[model samples]
Target chain A: MSIMRLLLVEDNARLASLIREGLDRQGFAVDWCESVAGAEHALKINAYDLMLLDLGLPDGEGLDLVRKLRRAKLMLPILILTARGGLDDRVLGLDAGADDYLIKPFQIPELAARCRALLRRPGASLGTTLIVGNISLDTAERTVMVGGHTIEATPREVSLLERLLRRAGHVVAKPALEGALYSMDAEVTPNALEACMSRLRKRLNAAAADVQIRTVHGVGYALFAPVSTDG
Target chain B: MDKAGNRKTGPTGPTLFRQIALRLSGFTLLFAAMDVAIVVVTYSSQPESLAQELLSLEAERVQSATDTDPDYLAGPPGADRWSARYIDDLGEIAGASVGSANGGRLMDWTRRERIAGGYRITGVRSVVRHGKQHWLLMQFEGDGIRPYAPVILDEIVQHVAVPLIPLSTLLLIFNIVAVRRVLKPLRQAEAEVDALDPDNGFHRLSEVTEPREVNTLVRAVNRALMRLDEAMAMLRSFTANAAHELRTPLSIMQLSLDRLPPGEVRDELQADTQHMTRLVEQMLDLAQADALAPELLEQVDLADIGREVVAAMAPKAFADHRDLQFACHGNTIVLGHAEAITRIYRNLIDNALKHAPGQTAIDVIAGPGPQLSVRDHGAGIADEDLPRLFDRFWRKDRRKTDGAGLGLGIVQKLAQVHGGTAMVENAADGGAVFRVTFLAAEPAKPA
Candidate 1:
């Protein structure tokens, strides 16, 4: 698989380097730009898989860059990485055509997870295989493998498992899971999504998968690799 | 208290209209008094001369009577009671000359002297009647009535004082209308001042439509407001800069920490960083609560905001092993800042999650009215600590809680900015309930 390349536009050198180091460990190649001018120049020279744009830059506003790229019909997914935590700023950034927003002081793991989630969307450049720990699900083949062995699963279980795998290690809210598992007009009972989640959990566990499905009671579910006992 | 101070203390003080009316009445009264004084002085000083003129007038009347009819003067006295006598010379009268001569002729030769009970005015005129030169004497006796003083006073009362009553009343009415008309612009400016929202620095009292005096005052107030706006803008920008400057380095530290291997020390450092982040965010929220402008407010559904906030915080509550539930009833439309309203619910739920024990339910209820309340199943707040719950930076057992105690204070401030109230009370069912009520707005009709 080809490496995922990201263009990061941030003014603070220390923060930019730290983000680069974090993303590099997550198997992403990051190109850092310290100003809007540098970012624009880099965008012209490099075809990036995604862009992490900061709102405040030395040369210009990052919102202006997002608008310019969108006006030029660039479909690359852009995630706003900034310290502007105001709700108005968040709405303004999203309305200016950025794909997502992450406030500063965020965990690097969370940032990488958000990037992966954005890339795994339909028509995105990411591959069809979703992996967390030893469990892997292939969207193109509609199959699940645990430790190189196939696991027979129902279509509904596969759908739930795919949604969980997409946002692995993060709590996926119950409404989001329901939206993924049911049609809009489907009259779903309150326990219907929980029932599906329970089935998926049982199937993955029965296949001796290295992942665990944890229920944050009354909130949602999360998938995480089991803590190694050897540690 | 002194009379003036006492009047000022209550509603008994004279209004601007009444004060102007009274002043006008006082001026009219002074003019009336001057009218009376002029009448008295003229009547008292000129009586003697007036009497001499009357005597001369009688003599002339007799002369004209004789010209018309030779026997007219020889006839008896007329109704005016002037006794006429013929004398060879005027030296018989026992009185001094009281009239002046003009052109070497005694044009008015008259005298006045005190009689037994009154004064007499007598005049002598030499004339030829039937070709005989003789002196004609005419005398007038007046009893000591002295009715001029009372007459003058009565006339003044009838003409000057009586007329002045209605005159001053009309003046008073005119004055009231004039005062109101002159103050119309000031009243408008007063309304503008009352309507000015302190959070909205753009509001200014109008200077164009006011009178010159009021315009000066309004211009001064507008200048002060301009200065206030500058200060507020500086404060807001400072807050933004502080957020950026503080959060950037914190983010770097968090990123570096995430790279450390899993251990107790790493976990403890992560916790400390998380606490610092929360503190910074709360401080920023406190600053923003003061900056919610009137333009940012709108008709939003408290139920909608309540549901969204509950759903968003449910994960945190669940991770802490506490159940979070939301309930809504009826229309909960309110005039509010939507994001601020969301923060209110978030803070209340966060507080409940922290205070309530694990395995307990935290219920968030949004109204039958424009109110949202959160009830947590835990030991209720102590009676003594309830009063300070909403105070900024005040905490109960500060060491026990991880928060900086700014959550409730922000809730209260945001509620107040929306023209609402936030209240806390210990519930009877063994928990504390926090309720925030907002100004209700009319629901929109279906299109």
Candidate 2:
């Protein structure tokens, strides 16, 4: 991956500068602007791969910019940054033509990962068999396998694992998992979730898989793709 | 003031209004008593003074009689009743004979005699001047006009009664008026205090035109209002700051999860997002609740909200292999916001299902306050843990669980906002019970 140019529009100079500095260290060139007007002018004057926008601005909200960009039919990736993470706000951000969204005070790595992933999205295949190393979950068969051993799973458990196996090395939150598990038929408890994950993790480990599922405290799950020790 | 009466500052046990009233009435009573005492003592002795004056006038009349010559002393002037004494040797009325009206001889005599019906019988007593004898005088006696009792009494009344009557009456009127005038400000201050509202209705009683006695009170009230205003301002700022700090990270975590590699990874991210969202929302709710103005209140049904929450939680319960059931006292309506009651039920059900083992029965009840309880066949909280359950982020086990710790705290907050309360206890039949209660509306009487 080459260094990508990012346009960061945020009214708060301190946070914008900090994010820019962090992203710069992460090998992305960030052009910072203080308002929507500045951002619009910058977009007209230059070409960029992605735009990072803070929704709180003196001139306009980030969502409004996303809307305007969408109306103008600009194809650049727009990630909305907002302090209000309300459900309606999240829905509104995505609905307004934002390619992705991030909440404030984000970790440099998480922000970087999202930015990289969003840039990669347009060129990626939706139907590709997601693979990391030798452990493979075949979408066609909805079966998980590591080194020729078929992993046995309940139909629901298979579905749950299939969703995770398809997106290896990304953080998955709980509600997203809930949506996939049951559709208004059953309610799941935290304990139930723990139980499901425990059984799933054991099944995967039993197949002598190289990777493991990691729990992120106060957050959700991380599918860790094992790295070659010699790296 | 202390027992030593040092400065005597601040509000006393008795209000200043009462003290002033007591003082006013005390002075009024004291003045009334003094006026009465003066009237009684003077009234009791007036007769003695009048009698003395009358006697002196009679003595002068006797002198006049003797001075006119003993032969001329035939009858008393303004004759009435008089006394006389006969002496062994007659004392001269300065060389004139005297007559007495009535007398008794004991020794030397002191008498005022009437000469109207007398023959020079020892004359009106004066001094003896013959034959070395200490004599008293006799006087003739008759009833014509005594001229003493009425005349002298008239003079006394004309002088003393006229002066004392106006003085006592003026003092009494002045005392009453002064006492009442002094109490006017206190009465106004008391009325102002009574008019105060517990929910910030009034700040201070204006005392620009009030008496000096209550100026301290006005100033104290003003200071208290200032402090209250400062406290409220601080609370508002705290709410805003907390909301900003807490909501920002939660939003970030949630937003970052979007476009998450859609599969198990995304699913885990979504769970994290939900946990973070729940925490953020609970914090926001707490902040909003503290700043709530009661005037924004609207009528809402707790029972309906309870049912709605139970419905919402049922899917989650089924996912966890738990059964959520609700029994209600039908039509259990209360006046409050539906969302708050909904939050109460959400937290209660979330709590019950979160902790309970799979396939356990969870029962929810809504009724006329105190009767509503959410029963979970989960591990019941210990007696000691029950008190701390409503505390924010306080879980009985320190183990970091998949769920946020703010659920029950939100329930308690909603309960407070509804003018009700929430509590938890272990059921006798083996379960944890969460009970929310609103004040039951008074039952309608027979029409």
Best by lDDT: 1
Per-residue lDDT of model 1, residues B298-383, tens digit only: 89988777766765675566556566777777668988877788899999998998887767888888887889899998998988
Docking class of 1: acceptable
How high is the CA lDDT of each candidate model?
A: 0.78, 0.64
Give per-residue CA lDDT, model 2, range A100-216, as digits (tens): 877664667678878877865735324335565557776667777777777787766666666666555654555566666775348766576678888988887788878757653
- Model 1, retained fraction of real contacts? 0.41
Give the Cα error of residue B269 in candidate 1, in Å: 6.0
Q: What is the TM-score of chain A alone in each candidate?
A: 0.86, 0.61
Candidate 2 clashes: the total is: 48
TM-score of each model, in listed order: 0.75, 0.45
Q: What is the Cα-based TM-score of model 1?
A: 0.75
- Determine which window of 10 residues in candidate 2 chain A has minimal summed lDDT: A122-131
